[model samples]
Structures are given as structure tokens and as C-alpha cells.
Target: MFRSIRHRLALFTYSWHAIGPASMLRNSVRWSADAEARAVDSGFDARYGTDTNADLTPGEADILIDRHHAATMYLPTMDQDLAAMLAALPWPESLRRDATFIDLGSGKARVVLLAAMQRFRQIVGVELSPRLHLAAVRNVERVRDAGALVSPVRLVHGDATAFDAPPGPLVTYLYHPFREPIAALVMDRLVASLEASPRPAAILYCHPALQPGFHPSVFGQRDVFQLAVEGGRQTRGFLLGWSVWTNDAWLDRTTIPVPLVSGAGEA
Candidate 1:
């Protein structure tokens, strides 16, 4: 058949052009080493995979609002990507010690574990999928028993749109976990919460390749950065973007101007 020949030709072209035998051997070794290092560094099972088997029944259709609005696919955050994001943020020890960090669509709760390890005042992970939520609970226990988690943490098994924001300044994180409709709803809720409480808040969004125009309207101007990570044969770069928005009241209360000394060095 023509399709069969085309598939064979495509495979042959890919093997010769993209991943040859030599490159495959080298990449395998590199990938193995990277995986081992990551497993040791991250106390949870943070392997990257998808939840393609997610099932939504007719009864649950009301919650999901049709299949298209259902749960987003599951993928664990890479440890290096998390590091890169934290590096870009204005994360002082005082903030980490006092802020409540929440992760929307917290699959496997890897970021929650990271927050716990960082000694955040409070750590919360909201996940809609029952499967991933259970996995997150187990991972939480594992990390706590290992003494990697130093702060109090909780895992909420529910829709992110319905979750309530905690009191205090927040560090909200999103990993491109859902469609725009759901994300928009959740973000609007968060902004409303901030407006009500008037606190400083920041949102860390990773893999924001979808809906480039959505963030500005929600989070205002976000600082964008690139993270270079190795895929198979070569290194690939991804966008790690975040924005900090403070309530007017919170800013007025907390924003203090730095005192400028004139001719102090002349003395």
C-alpha cells in the first residue's frame, strides 16, 4: 500500500536524519544517568508520563462539563525546571518561611513536596483526577517519612475551580494543567481572592505555549524565561514564565521605599 511505503520511508528518514545508531547509544547512556540523578535528587517518583486513560462517565459529565473540558493530561514537573523557575523568582528565605504555596492541578504533588522541602508556611496541591490525587497522597507520605518535607502539607482531591484560596500571601503555581475555560475560571477566582484579602501573590506558569494572549489579561505583564532541557538527542528549550501581582491595599501596606543616602561615601 502507499501508506505502508510512506511509513517505512518516514522511519528510514528519521533513523538516518534524526536518531542514528551512534546517537541512540550515546543518548541512552546520557538519559540513564540523568534519570538516576533525578530520582536521587527528587524524593518522589517524578517521572514524566501521561494519563491518556482518564475516563469521564456520564454522571461525571456535569462536573467536567463535557469531554473537552475534562481533566488535562498528567505530566510530572522536572526537577531542573522547578529549580529554574525558583531561580527566576524573588524568593527570599523570609517569603518561603511565611508564604502559603499552592499548586493547581498538582499531579503527583511533586511541587508540593518541593514547597514542603523549602519550608513554606503552608503547602497545598489541588488535583481533579482521583488517580493522580491518590498518587500524590502516597508521595506526600513517602517524602515526609524520608524527612525531606519540613513544612506542613495538604493534598486536596477536587476540582481546582472549586478550591478555596488559603489566607496570607500566596505563591500560586500552574503547569498548564487545563483548558482555557477552566484555567480562566480558576484564575479569576484567585484574583478575586487576592482582591478580597489584599495580599501579595505570584503565579509561576510552566510550558505556556498555549494561549499566548491569556496571561497578560490575568496576571498582567509576566517575566518570561527559557529553560534548556535535554530531550533525546539534543537539548530543547521551554518557556518558564511567571508574574507577580500585588493587591493595591497589600502594596500600600508593605511597599517601603529604600532610603537613599547622598554623599555618604564622601565622608
Candidate 2:
């Protein structure tokens, strides 16, 4: 509750940058974030080995925060449980062997790295922020140096709207990177790409806050469920959704809800 209050205060203070008092508050918040990031040394954060969630000021990331109507202020590492849930998707073995995985708005390349570990045929990450992109590149190098990645992976520093999907079957992942307008643009581009190639495609969307912006008829059936693991330690359950479409015209019109994981499903 306190953290939420602080985050709201930070955002409010950020909005009033022109004013003297509010500017001071924003600066203090920025300083605190930087200090937190500085405290993390080499391999500090186990997930990405970098302090991704800290150090970024709203003013510095205006393009991501304002230009795209993105709600996330900084790049976030994909949770390990979510990665496991992705691995547990009911995809065909043959399709998994051949599919190219793409992570849109892949801030620090956590998903990209995880996909590589999953042995996807090809892995791609698209990020809009140059600062975050640079960090992702470095993280990629770190993993490569440690002999972690086996599959071909590359990071592209570009806007989501400018990305072109790879040919053949593909699995695209999104973690609520941006709001409706940007998400709509990306979905349109994906539809255009599919129209050109007409191959099997699946979109794995986590925390789909702006899912309604996507066209209803474009997808076949969608799988919606919350991920939960039983045993040793449980990672927090997160609601995830996936939609798969193929080249067939008639099959594209089918719309059904297939609940796969445990717990209640959300739209």
C-alpha cells in the first residue's frame, strides 16, 4: 500500500515538472531510483543481472511513457513462473521446434534470453528505448560469454510499429508493454504480416490490459487462464492469454475460449 502511494506520488510529481515544488519532488524520486540502481553490483539481479526497474526517470523515458501511452515506466524482467507457463503452453512439439519467438517491447531482453534457452529456432527482441536496448545487448553478450544461449537471438532497437514478423510459424509475446493505441498499431502490423505470408501465428499476451483494442474477428479461439505451480515454492499466479491463427480463411472466424491453466480466467 505504501509503495502504491509512493508510485502515485511520483507520477503526480512527475506531471508537474514545470512547477518548482513538484520539480523538486520529481528530482528526489529520480535520485532515489538512481541510488537503488547504483547499489546493485555485477550480476546483482539474478533474472537479468541488471537493475532494470530502477534508475529510469519519467522525463528520460518520455517516448515510452508518453509517446506510446505506455503504463510501465521502466523495463521489467519477465517472471520465472511466467516463463514456465510459456513453456507449458499446449503447442505441438513440431511447431515448437520450428517456431520463431519474438518479444515485443523487450526492454532488457529477459524474454528474449528465456526464449533462446527454450531453444526456439529463432529469437528476436524489439525495443524502442536506445538506453534499454543497449543494456539488452550487453545482457545478451553476458549470456553468450557464459555459454548460455544455443539458439540464434538478436535484439533490434526500433519502435514496435516498425517491426516485420519473420516468415513461417511464429510466437509473439507481449507483457502489456503499451496502451491501446500502440497495441492496436502493433496488432494491425501483425495482421498485415500474416496476410502477406499466411502462416501459423500465436500471440502470448501477459497482463493484457488493452486486449479489447484488438479486433475480435482476427483471432480464432483464445486460451485464458492463470498460471500456478504446485510443490516446493509457488511463484505468484499471473493471468495470461493466447490466441492462435492460421492461414485458413474459415478457421480464422472461429472464436472460442479454451481455459488451460488453473484458477479463474480474466478478459
Candidate 3:
């Protein structure tokens, strides 16, 4: 509950701006979220004119989460219904294998943390906020101390604009958390990374800004899912994207989702 009139007044004074290069409308809203006094209080979701607070380091996971959550004003990440849908989707590879998953712009490591518990062999969370990254690390230490899954989950404080995608088969997760300019830049680096190792890759995008038809032509085909949030009634939705580069149409003259003949299963 907003104890003071000053905070309550924000609802009327809310403002949102669409700042984009193309990936998603990141850096749009400025909401002061307080997670105090409640077991699970989803923070504020307001856009007060132009949020000018810039990015500040609060601590490892705490700071990274702030940066991640701050970049875009989405709430609680994706809803449960949508998350379940993603969990059910057929990944490029089988879940039985220790899939290499990387959460780009992994604010506070929530998604990545959950994945680590789900039995991924290794999970990496990349965040631009150093403070937030540390907070996430603390959370990890806490969970690990409590006997969570034994997967190797790591968090790095780095900018997504120019970070290198790990050289191997990996799942790049996106939350429609950043603007398109950054998104394209990150993708460009990812493409460059693939050019060297040329391993199979998949992208899981949720609450993504990229439209349904927003397919990366460089890849042969992309799998997408849309889960509408009827409670909100806006275009608010959950979308997941997975693109495999080596499987492109021009590559070996094939345009399909089937595993390759030679480097098929885990290329």
C-alpha cells in the first residue's frame, strides 16, 4: 500500500516513452518499486514522464536486477502460464542433456536461477549492472547453501551490447528487456561468435518486443510462441524465439528445422 499521498499521486503522473532502435521499447518507464513488508509484492509499474535516474549499482543480483528491470518496465518477468508454455516447448536439443543456457540482460538472475534449479548443466547470466550482478551472486550462494541443484551457474557484469556469446551450442534468453538497437548489436555479436565455432543455437524470448513475424533472416527458421495476458488486455504478451544459424536455408542448400545429416543432433 502506498502510505503517502506523494507516492499514490504517481498513478496520475505516470508517463511512458517509447525509446527504441528496434529490438524492444527499452528505457521506457520509471517506476519506484519497493519490495519491503510483503512476502511477494511485485514492485511498481509506472512510467513517470522520462525516467532520469540512469543506472546505479545496488549490489550483485540486486543491482543487475535493477538494471535489467529498469531498462524496460515489464513486471514479474513473464507470467506463470507463459513460463509453463516455454518449459513445454521442444527445445532444439533435448532437456535430458545439460543444455548451456545464457540469460542476456539477466537482471537479478531470477530466470537463470530458476533454470539452474531445473537441471541445466550450466547457466550464465550477463548483466550490465555490476551491483545487480553481485546481488544475484549472493542469492545464488544462498540457494546453493540450501542444497539447490548442482549445476554451474555464473553471473558476469558486462554490457550486452558487445558481449561474446559462448563458443558452443547455447540457448540465448531474451525478455524483450532492451531496445532494438542494443538487441541488434547483441545479435550481431552473436552471429560473429557463431561464425567462428558455428555451433547450433536457440533463443528463448519472453515478453519480447520483437513482433511475431520478426524473424532473423540470417537463420533458416525461428520458433516463436505468443501467450496473451488477458488480465491486462493490452498487447502485453509472452513470445519466445529460437534461431539456429547453421541450419539456414542457404547453408548446405536446406531450409528446414530438421537436424543436420552430419552435425545433426548437437552440432
Candidate 4:
């Protein structure tokens, strides 16, 4: 009995010693990421509050809009699968040449930059966060410096829900950009824009939890496209494509409030 107890104690002690360093390293990495996110977020807060803030341009450029949000909202870059998917999407031209790739709630312009590199002719990224907007601009510069064939990235700091749409088709990409209330308003604006033109508008949502509300409200239509790549790191995550109504195929749908995943109480 004594020998077995000693053996078990010895194993436990060794295990504790082995796990201590690993746990510390894991926590250190997490804290480092948190610190980096906070530093960027704080800089943005210092520059801009909730309202839109303008930027100092090198020459004649449109006055921009930038907003500041909490650091907890910091999101990592796009997954490799999605990046490759964006890179692989046949550069829409000729038949779909009018399609304009717009990244609504675009944080740091990661998606915009990637799509641009993949030959997206006209691209736009609307970001509300000041720090993220600046960081995204720098990221694009870095890509160009590194000789990456980056597409033209137009950064807008104004509220995406009310940003002006240039004359052309719209392909909005939303990666769970915002909650229902905010997303609903944005969707309404996008639909109104399309109604004025009567063109094809498709929303490629990476992580859509409230798309149901976004749809029917914006374009009076809804369609979900799920893409799963083999040997992809993304597990069980799929992109949601919310397409606008076409003149030939029309379907009037009702708007609905999208609830939070955890529950209504949390929202």
C-alpha cells in the first residue's frame, strides 16, 4: 500500500511540474494577444468616439469616418479556407463585370485585401472602428510592399448602414458584422439601393446568425449557400449567401428580428 501510494504521488508531482510551464505559456500567449488588441483599440478610442472621425489624407481625398469600439470586439483575420476561397472565386467579369465587392462592417480590411488580390476589380471596405481602419490600410500597404497582387481597397469609415453606394452591382460580404437591430437597418438601406437600380445584389456572409432578418428586409428574398472545403482548418463553419431578388424571380418576404445565439436576455 505504501509503495503504490508513493508511486502515484511521484507520478502526480511529475505531471504537475510538466503542466505548469505549458499552462503558463498558454496564458502568456492569450494575454499577449489581448494586450495587442487593447493597444490598437485604445489608439482608436483616442482618435475617434462612437461618431465618425475624419482622416488626414496625403492629397485631395474624401473625408473619412472612423468609430471606436471596445477591445472585446477584436476579431482575428480570415481563416485560410475562406481566404483561398476568395482567391479562387472566378474574377467576376463580362457577364458579372458590374458586381462590386463590398465588405460591410469590414474590420481591418482583411477580407477586402484578400478579395482584391484575387482580382476583384472594384472593391470597397466600410469600417467603423478607427484603429481597425488605419490598421487595415497599413495591412494593404504591407501586402503591396511584399509584392502581393492586391486589389484596389477603398476604405470608408462611415456607418455602413448608410454608406452611399456607387452606381453598379453590389456583392456585400458580411461575416456576422453586427447584431440584428444594426444589421436590419443596414440591410434595409442596401435593399433600397438595389430597388433604385434593379440589379443583382448578393451578400456573401461568412458567419451569418441573423441573416434571416437581414434578408426579406433588404431585397425581399433569401438564399443560403454553404461551402465546405476538404482538409480545411475551419470546422463546421460555412458561408451564408443572402442574394437579392431578381426581376425574373421575385418573392416577397417579411422581415423578422434575429435573436442572439445565447438567448434574448444577453442581447
* Cα lDDT, all candidates: 0.61, 0.60, 0.49, 0.50
2 against 3, candidate with superior TM-score: 2
Q: Which scores better on lDDT, 1 or 2?
A: 1
The prediction achieving the highest lDDT against the true structure is 1
TM-score of 1: 0.63
Residue 157, candidate 2: Cα error in Å is 0.4
Tens-digit lDDT string for candidate 4 (156-186): 8767777877776566776555545666677
What TM-score would every model get versus the actual structure?
A: 0.63, 0.63, 0.58, 0.53
Predicted candidate 3 versus true structure: per-residue lDDT over 18-58, tens digit per residue: 33333233322212221221113222112212111222222
Residue 172 error, candidate 4, Å: 0.5
Off by over 4 Å in 2: 1-44, 47-58, 62-71, 208-267
Candidate 4 Cα errors over 4 Å, as ranges: 1-72, 81-93, 208-267
Q: Which residue pairs come into collision in candidate 2?
A: none
Arranged by TM-score, best first: 2, 1, 3, 4
List CA RMSD, all candidates. Answer: 11.0, 11.9, 10.2, 17.9
- lDDT, model 2, position 37: 39
* Model 1: lowest-lDDT 10 consecutive positions: 224-233
